[model samples]
Target: MNLKATIFGLLVFFISGQFALAQSTEIEKEITELSKKKWQWMADKNADSLAVLFHDKAKFVHMGGTWGKDREVDIIRSGGIHYKNADVHEVMVEVLNENTVILWNRITLLAVVGSNEVTNPFMVTEVYVKEDGNWKLADLTFSKLMTRD
Candidate 1:
């Protein structure tokens, strides 16, 4: 009966692993699409939409300085820093748990800072947390890269 029990345990483990993989894949797609929408929203200066997505205590890191959600929203709304365009070259998502995920994006960003427009290649890291059934952005950091492909 020990051999039968071992076989049953193995089957259960295999099935559970498959389920987890499938769930992670679904989350990956959802996050990827959400990220794409976020870029568009930033370009359009849709601060309201972004406000909903960003957590109240979210952190935003930039070349100028690091700030919180409110400042970021205001900057976008006021056009102080206009996100003109974002060309996403690569996207990767890691689901840490059901409630948390981390995403990395390699992008070429065009922005208007004050009166001058500039372009930069960056590797952006975004951390998302699921709260009350909604995925909220918790932290976003931009790391400037030297070369662009």
Candidate 2:
């Protein structure tokens, strides 16, 4: 009876570990897709779609300053800073848990600001939370890369 119980416990542990691994993989895939869509929306100046994706308390940090959701949305809407394109070099997503995910990406961004066009490499960090069965962007930070691309 002791042997049978120990074997059963080991089997359960192995199965649970596999389940967790599979869950994380799925979540990573979902977050990656969302991140791509976000870049597309920015390039297209689709503030309406972005508004839906960004959480009410979402924060955006840039080299110049940091702001909350409303300001970010307004900036995108008005084209104060246009995201013309993003040449993504690499992206990695980590599932913190069932409800949270973080993504980091390195990209060269083509942007226009105040009539000046610029291309810069940046490391972008994004945090997403699952709320009401949908993923919402909670935080976004951009760190300028010192290395010239």
For model 1, residues 1-149, the per-residue Cα lDDT tens digits are: 69999999999999999999999999999988988999999999999999999999999999999999999999999999999999999999999998899999999999999999999999999999999999999998999999986
Clashes of each: 0, 0
Q: Can you give the TM-score per candidate against the true fold?
A: 0.97, 0.97
Poorest stretch of ten by lDDT in candidate 1:
140-149
The stretch of ten residues in a row with the least summed lDDT in candidate 2 is 111-120
Task: Please provide, for model 2 over 54-144, each residue's C-alpha lDDT reduced to its tens digit, 9 standing for 90 to 100.
Answer: 9999999998899999999999999988999989999999898999999999999999876889999999999999999999999999999
Q: How close to the true structure is residue 9 of candidate 2, measured as C-alpha lDDT? A: 97
- Identify the runs in model 1 with alpha carbons over 4 angstroms from their true place: none
In the predicted model 1, the residue pairs found to clash are: none
* lDDT measured at residue 98 in model 1 versus the true structure, 0 to 100: 89
